[model samples]
Target: MDVIKGLLVLACAWGFSAHSAVNMQQEAKNISDLSQSMTGSKEALNTNVISPLSGGGSLKTFDRKEDFSFSIGTCSASEVFLKILTQPQSSGRLRLLAIEQDTSLDGNLDKFINVNMDADMVCSNGIMQCTNVDDFSTCSSFKWSAASDRTVGLTRVGMSELGGCYCISGKCGNALAWRNLKQVLTDVAGGISASLAAVNPYYTMSGVTVEGTQATVTGGNAQCATGSVTDLVSTTDPKKLASYQNDPNKMKQDSQTETASSWAYQAIQSGSLNPQESSEIRRCSEVRQPIIDSAKLSDIITLDSGTGGVGYCGADCIMLTLGTVGDNYWNSPCGEFGAAARFFIKDYKRIKSAVLEKAIFDDWIQILLNGNYIWSGPYNNWTGQAIPGQCELSTSWNINPNVSFKHLFNKNGVAEFKMRVMVADAGEGYAFARLTADLSCKDTKTDTIANSCSVYQNDPECTLLEERVDGVLTFSSGAITGLNPLPQSKTISQDSCQITIQRPWFNKNRTYRCNVKTQSDLTKAIARSEKIKTSTTAKDYQDIQFKNGGIVGDSGTLNFDNLPTVQPCVQACKVRKPVYPDVALDGVDKGVVNPTHYDVTYKECSVGVCPLSSGEELVQACQCTNDFAEATAIMQIMRNAGQDMICSTGIEKPL
Candidate 1:
């Protein structure tokens, strides 16, 4: 192979070897040791904590001047926020959680501060120390001193007031811990390890616009204001993920179904069908068996009337209903099977039509009784929900209309997010997650041909069960949660897209930045490559349209505040190339931009008429590329940072 290919091979090898050899537990312990000593150390300190994968994380610094302004309350276990920061990372397997803490210290420390260490992210049974030992030890004075720890809730505050102690206190600036440069270098080279994002608590951006220099955003709201974030960074290589081989659902299928079926079977042993609401209770588990084996169907007639509310009895054990249709709640019976109500609601026809069509049906209804997402779903198996008066959604949790929740993240290691926000607690906060992965799972079932998974794939009820087992099935979720998360700046980068255009007329000043946003579905993110635009205009100083209150050429470049609410033309401009009529590079602005100047380009060609049969040329076009209709006059604009607008009016001839 060539030199380039050889380099890649070597690089990949180095990454694997370094990660495989290091011990995560020891690395964390070492950092803790160093942080404990940073309190009184004389060394100048700088603690660098980063998340290489996910965004919305941060590093907080508390100088000797003050304690955190917010009073960390003391509570038991009501829903609270969580924040975790991971050290820089390597491959998927070599991941590690750096620091985990509640946004508010209101909950009792679970097992001395075990984080979301469930099957998803691995809950450490032992206490997870929160103090940044390496961070604190960087302090020259605090490094050499001894360490002291005080625990309140899940957060342990490590204070090293004396000198000499550095690496143990878990605080930065201590002389003993961060006195070496080589160590920091090693840490920087490896990358971030592990972390997570919010579990629920959809923070809504109550509909309102907050204007800014670059863009307008949803206004501040109470929902997202309470978010807080704490982060961590490490240097050692991380652990790898274990691959699954077998279907996980097989065990559940073997045990859970048997148990459930037996319980239903034993209920009939009582013999007295009238045990409780006799008819309804009997039909509850009784009518479901025939449809599973595909022998019959439900006739859904008079749907608008009431038949849609009841369940259906199909062939074999396949019992189809509104709530338990496709991958919905398990094919369970819902609603009453008594009297005229059953006659009007039983949806037998709909089931018959569905079975013939092989349609795995799902129905979701979100009504605005007032103005809210009266949260409902594709209930394929339940009744009384769509029955206007008997709808169960009305009784469910109230979805706040004044809220707008959004999850922001980049698949790559770098990410950031921001919002004009105010929580029930604070003004605004932000979180930048890095190094995120699926630690554990819930019902992550594997399937095989012997498992009739694809046949019932559309059925939500069967999804958790019918999906054959190839490995262990488990519940999983994110490891960290950022509350009131906002941001100072967002970093966007992409190598896939690259476009550049240079002006062939006159040079102009400009500015550029790459743009990225999560798709409307929020599953994947879309990015616009580096955008280069001119930021200049001939008349940066313009006046209001004679409202009997305007001046011209003396506005000192519109600042947008005094101007009408109109969209600005462009964002950036750079005058680099001199005026060009025809040269190799006279096309787009791909060349280096001039922040404080303008780049002008020009092009000239003979144009009259195309060479007809008599050698006569006819047409109003020249050799202008990029397909511009009017090359004689270009838009006029001045490139200036302080101007109200970047580009000028149309058809302004260049000097």
Candidate 2:
């Protein structure tokens, strides 16, 4: 959505038919409209910011072919620029300014250039480099994080090599003259691209063969003649690319990493939390832990990053891992305890700063904990020492004196809290549970709708229990008795620590219409063992991204228990019959309505062709493509069939 618009005056043309001028004009209008439509509140991202220039625009509805992209206005000044080139996805909503190269806004237009995005990281001097993890150490990752040094893979990617400059009205070309996306550097010692230059570009790529993990770029543009080839002539030195290839690998991978809280340290940094604000994070490294500790759990849980994410702490090797704590039982007697975290890794020498917006289990998680009939929520408290105000039970229920009544926490710079709870009952002495105020655990699918399933557990008599749709635990048996007898909530936290009142195993919705996740909804005065959330999907996932440390690709993994199948996504737009229908040009296309086609006024591109140009383009891009196995295999045959080519795109959002 973020992009730059420039007017082009056709001059020299190459690699394309002599129709550049007409095509160029049309492309300009298309790109401008697209970029303008996606710039602010209308952007595809969950956290859509409104730029004044965007005029509070509406969001563009994207299909599966659609991708999230916004060009940088400050390529040389901020980390946001680096994020685009290194790691291209954001699991959470973000403000572009957080990663801007220069907050000062004192640079010229040349300083603010548009970097075209594709499947790869376009390196300086025309050589291309791409990785799933964010390479925070590279200057290309961050314009001025360190002094510009070519040996560090920090220099500007060669414009000629990137290969998309406009040449004369209708022609396009690549800046670097290689067969495809990879350059044909002679001194680079026979790149994989070298042998495949003449081959169908996608056929020669290093890693596109794998499914759900790759996309490609080809050698040609809209017009068969113009594209990367014409753009490569502008480079002053041909071997600049060779020099880059010679640099030794700057860093290597490391061993395992450690994170203290339910939200690990590395995850914290990756999330890029700002500490100066009200809802800020503090340091545990600086504070001393009680030397004499009792609760100790061995490390069983592993934390790290793979595709669609960057490791925080700048070291490419390190990943956020929370060593396994407790045993399976600790996972949650009823599967209540949950956790999630975000990390922002950078190459610069600085501890990763991240905002860990953990899920607030509230009602959905409550269903699991109380499925056995225990109603509980946050206590009445507060802490005055912290910069941000914390809402906690003021009295600590007068039960467990050792557990503090309140603690400080943050949420987007606004004061927030993490609560430690206790089970208040007639029989129990004063059993207090240690709960993190950290909002890391999220795993609830719907806050409004219950997603409980049924299951049987324990060695006692066979009991028929309903697994609260979350797939966590089972509550009372239909035939009730001792462990089966009914119980009710006594009272809930009467203070600011937002708590929820729930009756254990009460399948029916809460008494009030409001909610059961927070204290405000406890007016009915009930009791239940307040259980903490265990994953990042508990609170209707409203404020959460489908992605987390557990997520792997653009298509998020499924939680059959939390999320269920839905009907195919479809919306029909009126077919626009071509203004001037074309007579039969190809046998298959003869007399076809072809109502979807648009004309070209730009001399830069080809008319009557698929929007896509190559296999790589067909695979990963947002454009309607012929990449479907049967469709693309057929297209390949058609390519061999020669001359009369025609194609159609996807019709809907698939399952």
Model 2, residue 257: displacement in angstroms? 40
Candidate 1 off by > 4 Å? 1-80, 103-450, 453-655
The candidate maximizing lDDT is 2
Looking at candidate 1, what is the lDDT of residue 26?
55
* Alpha-carbon deviation at 376 in model 1, angstroms: 83
- Ten consecutive residues with minimal summed lDDT in candidate 1? 282-291
Q: After superposition, how far is residue 613 of candidate 2 from its true place, in Å?
A: 34
Off by over 4 Å in 2: 1-53, 56-84, 87-579, 582-655
- Cα-based lDDT for every prediction: 0.23, 0.24
Candidate 2 lDDT over 267-364, as tens digits, reads: 67685454333222211111111111111111111113211122233222222222112222222222223332222222111212222212122212
Candidate 2, run of 10 with poorest lDDT: 1-10
Question: Residue 112 error for model 1, in Å?
Answer: 9.8
